[model samples]
Target: MPVATPVFDLSHIYKLSPETEDLRVYEKGQIIIEEDNGKLFPPSMTPDMGIGTCLLNERPREWRCNRANVNGAVGAVVIAIQFYRHHNYIANELHELNPCWDDERLYYTARDINIAVFTQIYFYELLPILLGKENMIKHGIISDSDGFRDMYDEDVLPQMTDEYHYALRWFHVIQEADIKMYDNDGYYLNTIPMVNVSLRTGFLPHDENLEKMTQGSFRQYGGGFDHIIDNDVSNKTVSHRLNKIRIKYSCINLT
Candidate 1:
């Protein structure tokens, strides 16, 4: 059975990140939950800059939003995990906060903390491979000919037979880690709702001229209004405190 694409009326309240192209797959209006066509979709996220920590434990809550997977391409899957909510435009809150340059506009808004918690794990896994002597060859992080394929092949993708390779370019790892930290510490503080959007479809149109839709695996983010902190000297010192959190909770969860 072909699952029809869901739609939201798209009000002026919703806020998109890139705002231009297919960078975002969302709809605004009423709350809608659709079956994911029964696919085993893995939720992934790449956060850049925040508390510099991962695996945030927060209260349970619900988020509502629309999602889709456009015509697929190689690595077309965007691992954009998020949380969302919908509401009417806010003419008052707009007047209240008085607004700022970096502020996001929306009366009732959806909130998201990309899967920063997960990406940290991936980065940690690469640490040993990156610092290992034999792993570091002539060019750079060889990453097996398939860009960490040897690490993921056996357990993750069973259908893949061809062995390919690519290095995790130095830029991606650094930038990705930075993004993860930002979300972890509430760098972008207009905390909204949370949902897990997964694009498990392949990177290309099927050989049969078909494309698979994305399965959104929603996860509740925070349930409090506390993530938003008052502007203060300490509040602006998230980066300097990263090491402190690292030292404090570094081993808290190891056991």
Candidate 2:
């Protein structure tokens, strides 16, 4: 018997349903798989952690925003550091919850974890203050205790300086401090992640394409942003000079 040709769709290829909503999905019985991308993936663990492109960090889950447990943070960091140190030549870069820290010897997992826990606290909280290292420290922006502070929390955001308002939001999202040492609310002088996109097409339907009525030329069923010709001279188009018209559609409200 000849093998039947497999019909493929999103469901056919992934052995999933058409209505599946999760962006990451695992195999029905597979033990280790990442749902980062939809497919049966092997562990992407590599000697070089792809520093330039894909990023994943092992946060102590304390510097994480919910609660602080230094010991727990140490365990997570030590595992990552040891794993990365042995395999550093392969992976591009690996970062822990804390960056650029100085502590006692990261000897064994026990030592590393202990140091890492305190480092996590200082990095997440004090590091920001240390950046200013001036009058800000006098104002309590930097403190030995990692107790949560409302002064830095993002609850009453939008009113703070643009830098900090954005910084708080960034911290909440990335779980790493975006800006360091905001004493009198001057920016720490760094770039924040903001994606800007602008797209334009140069071709407008040349000479004769618009004269004849086509499904794509009229307002009844035709044209939206780039879907229509830029030089559209029709009365229903956006540039209709003689008709001062306002369109009303139920799905939205037009002013």
- Which candidate achieves the best lDDT against the true structure? 2
Write the residue-wise lDDT of candidate 1 on 1-255 in tens digits: 111211111211122233512322233322222323332222212233221112222212211122332212112233321222112123223434554412233222322111222333333354544466355543353343434332334353222122211122222222211111122323432221111111112211222111212111111121222332222211222222123422211121132
Give the clashing residue pairs of candidate 2, or none.
47-90, 47-91, 48-90, 48-91, 49-91, 128-181
Q: Write the per-residue lDDT of candidate 2 for residues 1-255, one digit (tens) a residue.
A: 211111111121122334622222122211123222231222333435322111112222101110101111211222332222232211112124223422211122222333344444554555565366455456775554547433445463222244443333222222221112211233232321110000000001122111111212121222242322222121112211223432211111111
Q: How close is candidate 1 to the true structure, as a TM-score?
A: 0.21
| CA RMSD of all predictions | 21.3, 23.3
lDDT of 2: 0.25
> Which 10 successive residues of model 1 have the least lDDT summed?
191-200
Model 1's lDDT to the true fold? 0.24
Q: Estimate the TM-score of every prediction.
A: 0.21, 0.17
Error of 2 at 87 (Å): 13
lDDT of 1 at 65: 21
